[model samples]
Target: PEQAEVREIPAYIIRLQDEDIVAYSRVCPKGCRYLNYIPEPRKCSHCNTQRGRDLCCCGFAVDNPVLKCPKCWSIFDLARKGQILCGRAPRPPVEFKLDLDGESIVIASLQERIW
Candidate 1:
């Protein structure tokens, strides 16, 4: 029997090439409940409804490394501590320190680098 290696955490998880786990807040800081995830380059569905502009939240994994906001088009880099690549986000998303115990993952502390 094959055991499930992937477990869902409360936050948005990104598994790196080195098997390192990085987590971020799923909620966009720009006052939107739209959950961010790894997706191909395309126009955001939510933003598209409001405006006729094609906005991209394209960034996930090692290949594409920026998570753009669907609402304001704010871009955040996943590689460099989730720093703001561009756009008006006030600050980067909140990153949490994770710890693995057996098959369970726990959030140790909240990284408050961003306001």
Candidate 2:
């Protein structure tokens, strides 16, 4: 008689709620929740606690890092008012000159420098 051997399988952490399957990286640990930073890291990575309310003051480190104000250290919420009031106006179109050397032959000329 031959003995049965046990096979090892990869373990996965999954949650089933209302027929919805949510999967998380098991690498962190047995228990952990995703921390939403919104404009940045809103909670401590280890504790997963809400550090502070959204004051549009404390800059988040997750999204649009360049949009943070260095002086105040907060996320730039330009969309709060329903529109952005910053940015330069559009520039005027440039005009070009062309020279026809011969029949069916076209030559284009552009300005080299602006004075």
* lDDT, each prediction: 0.62, 0.24
Candidate 1 stretches greater than 4 Å from native: 1-10, 39-54, 57-62
Model 2 residue 32 CA deviation in Å: 44
Give the Å error, residue 55, model 2: 35
lDDT of 2 by residue, 1-115 (tens): 0132322311121222233222211111112222112223234232343453333333334322112222233232212210111222121111123333543212243323242
| TM-score of each model, in listed order | 0.65, 0.17
Model 2 misplaced stretches (Cα beyond 4 Å):
1-89, 112-115
> Best candidate, lDDT-wise?
1
List, residue by residue over 47-109, the lDDT tens digit for candidate 1: 455343434444223354456666676777666777776567777788888887777766778
